[model samples]
Target: MLDFHTLAEFSRANCVSICAFLVPANLLATVLTIILTALHRPLHQIWQAAGFASIFALIMVMHVYSWFAIGVVMLPTYILLWLAITCLLANLIAILWRRRFVNTPSLSNNA
Candidate 1:
Protein backbone atom coordinates (compact mmCIF):
# COMPACT_ATOMS: atom_id res chain seq x y z
CA MET A 1 0.00 0.00 0.00
CA LEU A 2 2.84 2.37 0.73
CA ASP A 3 4.60 4.05 -2.14
CA PHE A 4 7.88 2.19 -2.00
CA HIS A 5 9.93 0.62 -4.71
CA THR A 6 10.68 -2.77 -3.14
CA LEU A 7 9.44 -5.26 -0.55
CA ALA A 8 12.10 -4.27 1.98
CA GLU A 9 11.31 -0.62 1.40
CA PHE A 10 7.60 -1.34 1.87
CA SER A 11 8.25 -3.11 5.15
CA ARG A 12 10.46 -0.30 6.36
CA ALA A 13 7.77 2.17 5.39
CA ASN A 14 5.23 0.27 7.47
CA CYS A 15 7.58 0.17 10.42
CA VAL A 16 8.29 3.87 10.14
CA SER A 17 4.61 4.64 10.10
CA ILE A 18 3.88 2.57 13.16
CA CYS A 19 6.85 3.88 15.10
CA ALA A 20 6.14 7.46 14.09
CA PHE A 21 2.93 7.52 16.06
CA LEU A 22 4.19 5.37 18.89
CA VAL A 23 7.26 7.47 19.67
CA PRO A 24 5.48 10.75 20.35
CA ALA A 25 2.62 9.12 22.23
CA ASN A 26 5.12 7.46 24.54
CA LEU A 27 7.02 10.71 25.07
CA LEU A 28 3.95 12.72 26.01
CA ALA A 29 2.81 10.10 28.49
CA THR A 30 6.28 9.93 29.99
CA VAL A 31 6.38 13.69 30.44
CA LEU A 32 3.00 13.55 32.10
CA THR A 33 4.22 10.81 34.41
CA ILE A 34 7.26 12.88 35.31
CA ILE A 35 5.15 15.91 36.10
CA LEU A 36 2.67 13.91 38.11
CA THR A 37 5.43 12.18 40.03
CA ALA A 38 7.28 15.42 40.66
CA LEU A 39 4.20 17.25 41.93
CA HIS A 40 3.24 14.35 44.21
CA ARG A 41 0.14 13.77 42.18
CA PRO A 42 -0.93 10.23 42.88
CA LEU A 43 -4.43 10.74 41.59
CA HIS A 44 -3.43 10.02 37.99
CA GLN A 45 -0.51 7.75 38.65
CA ILE A 46 -2.58 4.65 38.10
CA TRP A 47 -3.91 5.84 34.78
CA GLN A 48 -0.50 7.03 33.69
CA ALA A 49 0.99 3.74 34.64
CA ALA A 50 -1.58 2.04 32.47
CA GLY A 51 -0.59 4.31 29.63
CA PHE A 52 3.03 3.45 30.11
CA ALA A 53 2.15 -0.23 30.12
CA SER A 54 0.19 0.15 26.94
CA ILE A 55 3.16 1.75 25.26
CA PHE A 56 5.31 -1.16 26.19
CA ALA A 57 2.67 -3.54 24.93
CA LEU A 58 2.66 -1.77 21.63
CA ILE A 59 6.43 -1.94 21.46
CA MET A 60 6.30 -5.63 22.17
CA VAL A 61 3.81 -6.10 19.39
CA MET A 62 6.11 -4.25 17.08
CA HIS A 63 8.94 -6.51 18.08
CA VAL A 64 7.33 -9.26 16.00
CA TYR A 65 9.18 -7.96 12.99
CA SER A 66 12.48 -9.39 11.82
CA TRP A 67 15.72 -7.88 12.96
CA PHE A 68 16.50 -6.48 9.54
CA ALA A 69 13.33 -4.43 9.41
CA ILE A 70 13.75 -3.43 13.02
CA GLY A 71 17.24 -2.23 12.31
CA VAL A 72 15.88 -0.01 9.61
CA VAL A 73 13.08 1.54 11.68
CA MET A 74 14.30 1.59 15.24
CA LEU A 75 17.30 3.86 15.25
CA PRO A 76 16.38 7.14 16.95
CA THR A 77 13.08 5.69 18.10
CA TYR A 78 14.68 3.23 20.50
CA ILE A 79 17.07 5.85 21.73
CA LEU A 80 14.20 8.13 22.62
CA LEU A 81 12.38 5.28 24.30
CA TRP A 82 15.43 4.42 26.40
CA LEU A 83 15.84 8.03 27.43
CA ALA A 84 12.20 8.26 28.47
CA ILE A 85 12.46 5.06 30.50
CA THR A 86 15.62 6.35 32.17
CA CYS A 87 13.95 9.59 33.10
CA LEU A 88 10.99 7.74 34.56
CA LEU A 89 13.26 5.46 36.57
CA ALA A 90 15.25 8.41 37.86
CA ASN A 91 12.08 10.19 38.87
CA LEU A 92 10.85 7.12 40.73
CA ILE A 93 14.15 6.74 42.57
CA ALA A 94 14.14 10.40 43.52
CA ILE A 95 10.62 10.10 44.83
CA LEU A 96 11.49 7.05 46.88
CA TRP A 97 14.59 8.65 48.37
CA ARG A 98 12.67 11.81 49.16
CA ARG A 99 10.04 9.90 51.08
CA ARG A 100 12.60 7.82 52.93
CA PHE A 101 14.84 10.72 53.90
CA VAL A 102 12.13 13.24 54.61
CA ASN A 103 9.98 11.01 56.75
CA THR A 104 12.51 9.08 58.72
CA PRO A 105 11.51 7.56 62.06
CA SER A 106 12.84 9.46 65.04
CA LEU A 107 15.98 7.71 66.28
CA SER A 108 15.64 8.83 69.91
CA ASN A 109 12.06 8.81 71.18
CA ASN A 110 11.78 11.10 74.23
CA ALA A 111 10.09 8.63 76.51
Candidate 2:
Protein backbone atom coordinates (compact mmCIF):
# COMPACT_ATOMS: atom_id res chain seq x y z
CA MET A 1 0.00 0.00 0.00
CA LEU A 2 1.13 3.56 -0.64
CA ASP A 3 2.40 5.23 2.49
CA PHE A 4 1.91 8.76 3.75
CA HIS A 5 5.44 9.74 2.73
CA THR A 6 4.84 8.58 -0.78
CA LEU A 7 1.53 10.40 -0.95
CA ALA A 8 3.06 13.53 0.46
CA GLU A 9 5.89 13.40 -2.03
CA PHE A 10 3.45 12.93 -4.87
CA SER A 11 1.36 15.84 -3.70
CA ARG A 12 4.40 18.02 -3.33
CA ALA A 13 5.65 17.17 -6.78
CA ASN A 14 2.33 18.02 -8.37
CA CYS A 15 1.51 20.92 -6.11
CA VAL A 16 1.69 23.45 -8.90
CA SER A 17 -0.70 21.55 -11.12
CA ILE A 18 -3.03 20.81 -8.27
CA CYS A 19 -3.19 24.46 -7.29
CA ALA A 20 -3.61 25.55 -10.87
CA PHE A 21 -6.74 23.50 -11.26
CA LEU A 22 -8.14 23.60 -7.78
CA VAL A 23 -7.60 27.26 -7.06
CA PRO A 24 -9.62 28.47 -9.97
CA ALA A 25 -12.16 25.67 -9.66
CA ASN A 26 -12.75 26.27 -6.00
CA LEU A 27 -12.92 30.01 -6.44
CA LEU A 28 -15.35 29.81 -9.30
CA ALA A 29 -17.58 27.25 -7.64
CA THR A 30 -17.69 29.22 -4.43
CA VAL A 31 -18.40 32.49 -6.20
CA LEU A 32 -21.17 31.00 -8.30
CA THR A 33 -22.85 29.43 -5.32
CA ILE A 34 -22.70 32.66 -3.37
CA ILE A 35 -24.10 34.61 -6.27
CA LEU A 36 -26.90 32.13 -6.74
CA THR A 37 -27.80 32.37 -3.11
CA ALA A 38 -27.73 36.14 -3.12
CA LEU A 39 -29.90 36.31 -6.18
CA HIS A 40 -32.52 34.16 -4.52
CA ARG A 41 -32.47 31.71 -7.35
CA PRO A 42 -34.54 28.57 -7.47
CA LEU A 43 -33.70 25.91 -4.96
CA HIS A 44 -32.90 23.39 -7.65
CA GLN A 45 -30.44 25.74 -9.29
CA ILE A 46 -28.78 26.53 -5.99
CA TRP A 47 -28.61 22.86 -5.21
CA GLN A 48 -26.85 22.14 -8.49
CA ALA A 49 -24.30 24.86 -7.84
CA ALA A 50 -23.82 23.64 -4.28
CA GLY A 51 -23.25 20.15 -5.64
CA PHE A 52 -20.38 21.39 -7.75
CA ALA A 53 -18.99 23.33 -4.82
CA SER A 54 -19.14 20.18 -2.70
CA ILE A 55 -17.11 18.30 -5.29
CA PHE A 56 -14.38 20.93 -5.11
CA ALA A 57 -14.58 20.88 -1.33
CA LEU A 58 -14.03 17.13 -1.33
CA ILE A 59 -10.94 17.57 -3.51
CA MET A 60 -9.63 20.23 -1.15
CA VAL A 61 -10.19 17.85 1.73
CA MET A 62 -8.07 15.20 0.02
CA HIS A 63 -5.33 17.69 -0.70
CA VAL A 64 -5.33 18.84 2.92
CA TYR A 65 -5.28 15.24 4.09
CA SER A 66 -2.24 14.54 1.97
CA TRP A 67 -0.39 17.38 3.60
CA PHE A 68 -1.54 16.36 7.06
CA ALA A 69 -0.39 12.80 6.46
CA ILE A 70 3.15 14.15 6.23
CA GLY A 71 2.81 15.92 9.58
CA VAL A 72 2.66 19.33 7.97
CA VAL A 73 0.20 21.17 10.15
CA MET A 74 0.72 24.73 9.10
CA LEU A 75 -1.85 27.50 9.37
CA PRO A 76 -2.51 27.60 5.63
CA THR A 77 -3.18 23.90 5.50
CA TYR A 78 -5.45 24.13 8.49
CA ILE A 79 -7.37 27.04 6.97
CA LEU A 80 -7.78 25.24 3.69
CA LEU A 81 -9.08 22.13 5.38
CA TRP A 82 -11.41 24.22 7.50
CA LEU A 83 -12.76 25.97 4.43
CA ALA A 84 -13.39 22.67 2.72
CA ILE A 85 -15.23 21.26 5.68
CA THR A 86 -17.25 24.42 6.10
CA CYS A 87 -18.26 24.47 2.48
CA LEU A 88 -19.31 20.85 2.55
CA LEU A 89 -21.29 21.17 5.74
CA ALA A 90 -22.91 24.43 4.71
CA ASN A 91 -24.00 22.98 1.41
CA LEU A 92 -25.40 19.89 3.06
CA ILE A 93 -27.31 21.93 5.60
CA ALA A 94 -28.66 24.26 2.94
CA ILE A 95 -29.88 21.33 0.89
CA LEU A 96 -31.49 19.62 3.82
CA TRP A 97 -33.10 22.82 5.01
CA ARG A 98 -34.58 23.53 1.62
CA ARG A 99 -35.95 20.03 1.35
CA ARG A 100 -37.29 19.72 4.86
CA PHE A 101 -38.54 23.19 5.74
CA VAL A 102 -38.63 25.45 2.71
CA ASN A 103 -40.73 23.11 0.61
CA THR A 104 -43.23 22.23 3.26
CA PRO A 105 -46.58 23.98 3.20
CA SER A 106 -47.84 25.79 6.28
CA LEU A 107 -50.72 24.20 8.10
CA SER A 108 -52.36 27.41 9.28
CA ASN A 109 -53.82 28.03 5.82
CA ASN A 110 -55.86 24.83 6.06
CA ALA A 111 -58.08 26.25 8.79
Best by lDDT: 2
TM per prediction: 0.46, 0.68
lDDT of 1 by residue, 51-76 (tens): 66456535534432433354645566
Task: After the best TM-score superposition of candidate 1, give how far the Cα of residue 110 lies from its true spot, in angstroms.
Answer: 15
The count of backbone overlaps in candidate 1 is: 0
RMSD of each: 7.4, 4.0
The parts of candidate 2 lying over 4 Å away from their true place are 1-9, 96-101, 104-111
Full-model lDDT for every candidate: 0.53, 0.78
Give me the runs in candidate 1 sitting further than 4 Å from their true place.
1-13, 43-47, 50-54, 57-111
What TM-score would you give candidate 1 relative to the actual structure?
Answer: 0.46
Clashes of 2: 0
lDDT of 2 by residue, 3-47 (tens): 967767777779778767876777678677767766667889879
